[model samples]
Target chain A: MDVGIKIIDSRGAACPGPITDLARAYRNSKVGDIFEMWATDKGVKADTQAWATKTGNEILETREDPDKIVIRIKINKR
Target chain B: MKKVLIIGGGGGGLILANHLDTNEFDVTIVDKSDLHFYQPWFLYIAFKGSKRKISRPIGELVRPGVNFVKDEITEINLDERKAYGSRKVVYNYDYIAIATGTSPDPDSIPGLRQIYDEYGDYHSNVYNSQKLWSHVKNFKGGTIAIGQASPTCKCPPSLLEGAFLLEERLRGMGMSVGTSDPLSPSNENDPTKTGEKGKSRIVFFTPFPRAYSAEPMNKVVEPMVKERGIEVMPFFDVDTIDVQNKTINSLEGDSLKYDLPIIVPPCKGPKIKFTPETVQDEERFIKADKNFMKIPGYDDAFAIGDCNTLPTSKTGVTAHLEAMTVSELIQGKYSEFNGRINCPFDTAYGKATFVIADYNNPVVPYPPTATKHFMKMSMARIYWMTLMGTADPIFERFFNITKPEKLNRKYSVPE
Candidate 1:
């Protein structure tokens, strides 16, 4: 079955908020599920990357806008 | 003279208002509370039961020329450069600086608000700190859960500081305490193994996988924590508190039993309203340029301290530096802030370390020493001098030694 991308909007949340939101969503998500997170906290950039790297997830892309940051990740592990 | 309206008479607002050239600008400060608090003292108030010298009247702190208005700022119309206060007063300003820092949101977590309401916490205010002291002062031995409920909080090191100090206080009270490594996983209730039956066990929790978010700082702190027998529960972001059961739950599917819970409540920006709503972010923190501290599209408008989205830790030191930088910027003396962080870490037993860093350099913990501890303690007493700019010469000299360039060179750490 094809899985749809889950959007986790964590804008205005600070460090760990975005990461935690992603982790929470990832835990309930099925394998092969894709996730996109939006955050305003600058720490989200490094945190999302580190969290993905540690959790064995693949970063599909990371887009940075003037006001917010968006990260796309594919779950590779439980 | 140009009228400058400063909302919130906090460390950043007071410092900026005091340092600004009174000859060139007419400054007025508006705050809900008439008192200025030395917030760093909250830790002492919690752990040490200190009740003196932590606050001063905001009126006394403001310089001779600065007008102090005791009213809550309800709205800020940046386009019109007007601010509305709770007293139904509207003030116009040529330039406006918002230093209204973040406020602790007790209700952010489930059951957490009631927990603090009943038992109190040091993070909230003087009353809460005192109430926390009363709750924990007579504690002999039990499970003391000290950690953060929020992902972001002011003074990141305060969690560890409280743990170390509380552990020390327990030991000083002649109680045997042993640490349980939550990183080890198995949640077997072996009180005999962890020494929880007849002794005090401090379980320090953090959302990060490591004891501290910063790796190098973690390296320095983890050892001290382990040495002091403080149990660490990493990756445990507080999800909720079961007050009846006396249990703390984490978002990561872990729960721990506790006798006394002293979790740092979540924080959010002030309740002040902005007309366009774009002035603040989702969490309501004012968005401003990292270098200039100026709100976008408005050259004369700025936000500093916990109120501004500076991408740094919410700390008084960050606020102080930004205040100084913005004060100078208003005078046409532009200096870019290097995201300097100078947080004093008290590791208990009269030893402390200064976690000094900036955007350019990583935090290299200075070897814990009594001198640093003393300096940290002394600053609490002389903090008023800093707000008044009376200690500028000495403070600037001290800051000079801890500058990012100096720290980078001294520690020889890569950027």
Candidate 2:
């Protein structure tokens, strides 16, 4: 079964704000679920990637549009 | 007897030096420059006719017992626990406190120094009140753009103060005020050129999306900017300056031209070579434990003030509080240092100001108000008096003494 978690894209929320919100949403999710984060900041791509790598999660896919970007991460079921 | 050596004789260094007991430890303060500036007042000094009142000789601020050295520190040899100076003197320390506050590097931007050289002789880089007053008195008004080049820049309110005070001073000089579209090049190529000859327009640009990144303050400042008719352009990094044209190009493809531009260049730690482990974060700012103010892996080395990567605003007040905490730790009287820092700011009549950060939490966050006006003024007086050796004992006691429970609470934050 595939579960989709949508994080309202916090594109321009400034430093630490978007990161904090993403962490909160990720924490509330179950193992093996896909968390989708929408962010508008160019810095968020590297930030979210770093966050995933540090947490041992895997990025399933990332798609970017002009104004916003959507990132999908697969949580490790540790 | 443990010897405490403090580098940089600015607000943070001086506060730490004063808080330490002279008899117990031999404290030596070293700074490269001969003059110690009341830096916060540079804004007012630039425009007001009272520059002399704001700056005092560095010698006046040192306590009777402290040894002051006038020399530039070239390097900090942490492995050997020594600092070398241009005077060829090497001072070793039982405890070292780093408080060399931030310095602007104008060289980082193209054409910045040239523009500054041509147009800024009347401005104070540190404290040029005469220059500020001269610029204000010259009176022809055009677009005034204030921009911060880096995220770690000191004192955002200073830029706000410049905008407000310039407006007030220009109006008093019989110049009219006008509003232009936000000064982004994408919106219009020439915002300042479109203005009338005698009218002054002001535009403020920040790299961040909001006026102030910190909450509540941002909320307050955003509306205040709107109310004051100051154009706010957020999230645009400055790419370069066209010195010939007096225009600034943004990384986001926006440009702004100004008649007089007061730029706050990016600030960085003092030029010091340190091992990766000795410094913290991407910036080479000396790293200290969040609570104890101790450099990790080194017992005797510590950092306080803007030189360190403290989470709080890089103001004198934060340094003073951290100095008290670090002094206690150095004397072995306290096992740990703990305190919360809250930077309180005020915006009055479109001019913004800040007061001593009230660390007593839950933080009482408020915008600049009437009461804060007196607080800011009195605090400036306290700073001046302390530096001048004339502060009453009561002010010293209030800042130095801390309750045990508060200390314990602060240490609870994980490093």
Candidate 3:
């Protein structure tokens, strides 16, 4: 809800489903486009971080709310 | 309906397209040829069976309602979710399963294609099985070398089968078959050379350390080679073929001269490009999940069979099981892919050897038996039924057990 951020609701999605949504979102995002994925799947944290690290993106912020893990990623040309 | 497009109509694609729910998904398979041949039958075809009897038209194979396209795939863009074909047809899909499989690129090896073309190396499978027949049939009987070009060759046991069957053929012709290499015996302690010149000699070569990895298989095969007087030349990593010298030099500082050479040329993966990292091995097999579902970086792409490095035997049976797993994963059913491989190796004259393996136990090649020969024949029929989609076997339980689907018929050739 800031200057430029895409909030992806992945609460009910499965392991790769949410990760896939995160990837698809990253695919469509421009440079400096921020993304926050709210995921209920516990594996999403590792998957997302691994994907981001592999694809050369920056993780802006990460925190776990009571119900789901929230991750913030910045789209880098890297 | 989710649109599923599959490339390569060999085993995995054929089985996957048939098993995919026609009601829930629009399945289309794109392949260059309208022919889907049972590959194992190539061995039989080279010996006694006819090519026409083993290969069938692709038009008759796929289940009804599944669309088949006769176009060669030129390029696959995972990011765009599109595959370009030779006919210039561009197709998009919700999901794509690549079962392009491995190919023996003789051209990839310097002078291999030339030597094969010049002398007619028929021991090779996939191609020249028919040509091998003519080569064997016209044989007045000398030395026939069944050797591998490298370690990455798919289905190494099949080479043993070719040697065994051809040895039996030469023996049937009343020619002395030699298993001991007169040129390069393992050591002085090894069996003495048993064949004189002009008699048919069968020296089998491989890059593997042993004839078969498992001890029990070694007990059987080593003795089989010794009994039949066939020679074993292991640790030969051939790099180039000097056809004039009738010798093949190896990358591992080894060389061997041969009369007729059947080289399973160093196999390479399909030429299609993928954008994902760690998605393929250095040799080009797509790295796959145990279940053969979803390339890690891409959302909707998956790979099966020899095209994907699943650590299973790169055989049609492994591809068949992978197809079942793919169906279970996509149709909203649960499945776990563990590496499982079973191959019934036809030894010759209505006899065969059996291998059953998994990730935990690894490769355990069991004893040879006549029953496994019949079992292999039964597999050919099962292959037909699978193509026709008539005898489609499905997973009855979601347990992590390997092939709860074929647990019954499995006992016919139980490990």
Candidate 4:
């Protein structure tokens, strides 16, 4: 989807960073603002989805590319 | 099925209550609080580093095959193997797992109880993550004092994190930090080191001879504290808190004053009426052998958790690790619990350091990094998920994942 997204490039960042930043972006963002995060922590992808489900946000897409897992999330009003 | 009674619905107790086979054991879980909270998150909440709703009603969380009882336990007749609760209810168990945990006894300390009676977990209970949200929300910058009201509070790294988080909280408010002129650097705890016009100074006090109880962590933390411009006063035992004067007096003829004191009160054990054999000290911390097995005399009883005199840090992680051994011990098996504490220390200015230690080892210095902080954040979710039975058990066994060891039950059940 063609949307203005904030790239939270937490590449090489650890566990909480990716999701913590994602939560922050979700808070600061307007509806439809996508937060795309890149993290080297292998658990980030699964955790991101889990966080999304808990917070009532949507994980738009998750892709594994190169050395990091990339996740895109949409800020939704819960 | 053997009747098992698990006391307290917190960390170690809850984990054991969830994992124990219902088909083989009739387990009953009782706790005073109707609600169960994800406690470790209280650090983030108190520091204003993160805001997430981390609580759930205990009624909803107790899994199938476990009888949940919400009652204030009045007494435990260890000799009779019976626990008495409010409403004159009596419970008999063939086996018991005590995980009642520790407490920061404000009542035992003069002026501290008054402080709580006035401020209500201003530092301690919030640190316990029991009641923290409003405290963190209303917090503004000032001369913040993070001190230990007494010795051996759970999670020694807490105040260090509190100061670090407060530093970040104040700075995030556009406060000038690190410099006396709000621009030029002075020494640690310089009067003009915070807020819009330098309205903050962070002072940390501990009863320990060093910044951390563990010496190796001190080696790493002392320097970091210096670099962050945090002042530390060690070997100071807080005896009296003269709230009227805003000064805490030490037993050793010294006094330190503060505008806001975020202190860890003295940790005291629960008042369970266990037999002398079941407890270690006068405080009633449970007695478990090195392997966290075989509580002397009561062969049917196994104890683990912060309430135990485990010769380790009284932390949720420690209790979680030891729970594995306690469960096996109840089943006539022996499992050695290598007391481990994996902690992440946040400088709160977008930086963190991970501290990994065991019962005997002190933590060596490691660089503050984002990766470690991330792990700390992820751990909370993983822990809760595992407890909820949605996540795999392997998630809870993070460190033990790779250890190719035997899971053997060395002892046979008493026929």
Candidate 5:
């Protein structure tokens, strides 16, 4: 069974801090799991896209509302 | 065994020396000064009073087998493959790397040095801190003008950083010097209102049309400057400095007065002789193929860092990336010379922005993209760690991308 992890909303953090935290959390989780990150920093959208491209991770979805960014990632069990 | 001699101990010289393999080529580094400074942190040190803990003894940065020489290089006899230094030592090398960085030439402007010496309190940065600190404390709201004498200046953001932080500090002290008239009447009369001495009103001026000529940065810096309420007078070249009058004469028949003036002087490469064949440009900057970093005609001699006249900004990050490319070319790893190199820059908000350069075509091109700020920050850590004699695993892997033989092919000296 795959595990689902969530990063409870990072609203006002600076660049790379939120992304770094999310990356660190994802690294500790088991392969083939799902990670969801909520952020308010608009740069996170580009950051997540770049992270996925560099790391070869799968991005399930990225949703943007007025105040926050919701992103979901599926880790490939390699 | 190949002998590589590197001149200058700044960011470029040190990193290239650190990156070379110990088993293959013997490296010798010659530098005039013993101290290795983390210059990027100098601005932070001046404003925030934060000391950078990143420096190390110059000796520690060199690889174990590499020879370190402390002397100023007097001349380079490129024809004979020998270099002479002030210590009366003649060193011969199979290859030479020039990384000597630029220095401020205050002497170029008449009366500028005298003014600087007399009004030392106005400009406070890494070079002159004690005077700068005292001046800042005693500043009592007058027109503060920051200007650059020439182009090709390093850390253009330093002036902006100082202005912004000074404004914030002054405001915190209840001295509200707005952007319009930094030395408002209220600021001059009330010494206590200015933090320590009631210094108010600051104005920033640059000779360039834009804050930074480089793109992406140019896009962001102007907004930040205006946001900080710093007045920028573009294209105002200085003709002379009238120290007695506390005024500056501009080439365009304009005169600007200042209570305090911080001037960034013009920068130039050190006086060194290169064989006419070696340097194609009149300026004597080493002429190298943009793609391979190889000196035209001379296979053994290569130039890196500020010493060479590369088209890109003369920053440490650019030097590091170029060194990697040059190393790969020297190692004969042509296959890996995929005509692309990553140039990373630090943004206004302290984020690491980068562009990819493709050098194969006639027109060198760069794409607009930025990496995670962590990656940029981590690279800085990697540089510090490597300089401190600890090879991080991540950087080591990154360095291994291009084989050594590919690097050697592009830089072979003629027999």
Candidate 6:
């Protein structure tokens, strides 16, 4: 089965919204499933990294553009 | 004269109503309740057993010219520029400001409301704060767990500050503050591992990875937290509180036993209905420009304070600054809110620190000092006058002094 990466769009959402979206996505995801998230809040970078570190998730990539922040996470554990 | 209608009579609404040019606009404020409460006082009430004056009649705080009406707004007719109230009164306005702020929703977390009701908490109304005070005063020394049920709550640093203050208070009562590993399997049966009984432990469970969300502020606070022996359990986004078991289980599959658990409740936007649906998001937070506080698709409508989806913390300081920005936008003045935040963080022992930040800057925290503590203590007394813009000049000076953006110039200059 070819499963595309799930995309979670949280653009323009404030602090904690991005993290909450990531968590909600994590709940339905299996180990090794990768998800991409987009957020506009500047604090999303720090928040995402912190949340990933504490939750035992892996950040595959983080790219920041002028308009939005894009982050990819691979589920490491439930 | 243009009619200006302000909703919710909160920090932002009251300031906007009072600051508008009364000569050019007929101002009115609509709120469900007549009481204007200084919510920061809830901390003092819970920890210090303070009976300090914190509430005043809304009418007493509203300026002489601004009409203060007691009415709960239910719906807005955008096309007609009319707001329908629960009292069946219709309000007409040339411009409207929605400042109906967020409320603590304990029901958001499973079993949270039950625990909150049973042990008392400081996150809701005055009665709940008083209940927490009773519990704090009568605490016989056990595991006191402070955690946040929601990731976003008003005064983001308040729970951490409460922990520091609580630890100090318990220690002052001759209760030995102990340390325990919350994740240890045997710890639940014996939460406190101190040498003697009646020893207390402060375990702070947070959704954020650090003690403070902002790294710079966390750098300053984490050390203080360790110095005070406050155990911080990071990534503990609360999932449920087992009321019968006296355990709080996190979404991360961990649980901690507590004799007393104080959870900061989740904040939700006002329940009022808005026209054109675009006025508010699915979360019910009003949609507005972060800098101008102006609602999209409407030139004359504005949303400020906790109701708006601003990127800053949900705090009165943010509301006050947004009020100033919206007030300027209404009066044909050119101004932009730089996302200034100047919140006081109480570090116990009669000392406090200021969390100062802006859009382009991370939080810059000063060392905790008695001077800042006194300033925070005096804020409640002067808050009403501030609504009337009586302290505008003083606030301007304070903001300038604490502006993190100006730190380079401040330190670079010769003494």
* Best model per DockQ: 6
Off by over 4 Å in 4: A1-78, B49-51, B120-142, B177-197, B276-280, B388-393, B401-415
Better of 1 and 3 by lDDT: 1
lDDT tens digits, residue span A1-78, model 4: 455777876553221124434543443467667788887645467667665664567888889997768888887743
Deviation in Å, model 5, residue B188 alpha carbon: 13
Candidate 2: RMSD over Cα atoms? Answer: 9.9
Candidate with more favorable, higher TM-score: 5 or 6: 6
Q: Which stretches of candidate 1 lie over 4 Å from their true place?
A: A1-78, B179-198, B412-415
How well does chain B match by TM-score in each candidate? 0.94, 0.83, 0.87, 0.86, 0.77, 0.94
Better of 2 and 4 by lDDT: 4
lDDT at position B70, candidate 4: 92
Query: Compared with the true structure, what per-residue lDDT tens digits does model 6 show for residues B250-271?
Result: 8777798888888887777888
For model 6, report DockQ.
0.28
- B96-208 per-residue lDDT for model 4 (tens digits): 88878876688766788776654444334443333443544455555666776765466657767877776667656655444352333442444543432435667777655
lDDT of candidate 5 over B1-415, digit per residue (tens): 8888988877777777776776888888899877677665554454455555646667877768877888998788777899899867898998888777776567777767775565442222354644455565566766666666544355444445566666665556666554443345443344333223444555665554445432233454466556645666654556689988888875434577777776766556667766554473433456655555666777777777656655444556556656665555555565122233343444334444343322221111122224444565565556666553355465546445422233223332223
True contacts kept of 6: 0.17
- Residue pairs with backbone atoms closer than 3 Å in model 4 (clashes): A15-B374, A16-B374
lDDT of 3 by residue, B1-415 (tens): 8999999888889889998879889999988888887778777767663554666777678888899999888788888888888767789998899988886678866779986665444334445776777777667756677866665555646778878888777767755665443433442322234324336677787654446533335556777777777777764556688888888876445677777777766666787766654577666778666655577776578898877755445677678778878878888778866556666777776788666554434344356689778877887776778655566543223123434234324433343
By summed lDDT, the worst window of 10 consecutive residues in model 4 chain B runs over B404-413
Q: Note the residue pairs that clash in candidate 1.
A: none
The top-ranked prediction according to TM-score is 6
Model 6, residue B221: distance off in Å is 1.3
Model 2 over residues B1-415: C-alpha lDDT tens digits? Answer: 7789999888778877877889999999998876777776666666555544655666768878888888888787888888888867888898888888876667777977775554452223543345545666775867878767555566545555666666566656756555643322233324435455666677787665556544334555677666555777765456689988888986545788888776766667778666435475445577777677778888888888877755445666567667777777777777443343434354544333332223222222244667656766666667766643356376447544433234335432322
Which stretches of candidate 2 lie above 4 Å from their native place? A1-78, B121-129, B180-193, B275-283, B335-365, B386-415
Overall lDDT per candidate, in order of appearance? 0.80, 0.63, 0.68, 0.64, 0.58, 0.80
TM-score, candidate 6, is 0.89
**lDDT of model 4 at residue B74?**
61
Number of the predicted model whose lDDT against the real structure is largest: 6
